[model samples]
Target: MQVQVKLFAFFREGRFIKEDKELPTDTTAGQVIDDLNIDREEVGVLMLNSRHCKFDTVLQEGDIYAIFPVIGGG
Candidate 1:
């Protein structure tokens, strides 16, 4: 299955902002994060096809997944 991944904020540093990825069936959002070497604690939001989703959410083929890092400011 193929899915598009979009990284936001500091997540894009030293990496791409968006790219197509081929994953196995029944792959979860958390797996992708791990494959990308992103810390789960740093993730602020996970979106699948424009809707908010959890890390355990199962990804589908052709789905658009976006990951945003947590932002902190005073």
Candidate 2:
């Protein structure tokens, strides 16, 4: 199975390019990030097709996902 992953802000700054990634069956968003050497702690929100998702959220083939960093208060 394959899924599209979009990394933003801090992630992109970390050298991650937004691209379609091939994920194995039963793989979760966290797993994909882990495989890519990304730390889940750095990501504030996770979305699957624009819906809030968790790290444990299992990925489906052809699914689109976006990850964003958390902004702190002034």
Candidate 3:
């Protein structure tokens, strides 16, 4: 299956802002994060097809997944 992935904030540094990735069936959001070498602690939000989703959420073909990093400010 092929899915679109979007990275936000620092997550995009030294990495692509967005890309289409080919994954195996039954792949999870957490698996994508792992493939990107992103720490689970750094992930603030996970969205699938514009809806909030959990790290364990199973991804589907042609799904759009966006990952936002934890933000810190005063």
Give the per-residue lDDT of model 1 (tens digit) for 35-65.
Answer: 9999999999999999999999999999999
| TM-scores of all candidate predictions against the true structure | 0.94, 0.85, 0.93
Off by over 4 Å in 3: 72-74
Q: For each candidate, what is the lDDT?
A: 0.96, 0.83, 0.95
lDDT of 2 by residue, 1-74 (tens): 87889987778875666788776799988887787677878879899988999999998988998888786667
Steric clash pairs (candidate 1): none
Q: After superposition, how far is residue 42 of candidate 1 from its true place, in Å?
A: 0.5
lDDT of 1 at 40: 95
Q: What is candidate 3's TM-score against the reference?
A: 0.93
Model 1 shows how many backbone clashes? 0
Candidate 3: C-alpha lDDT: 0.95
Arrange candidates, best lDDT first. 1, 3, 2
**Candidate 2 lDDT (Cα, 0 to 1):** 0.83
Top-down TM-score ranking: 1, 3, 2
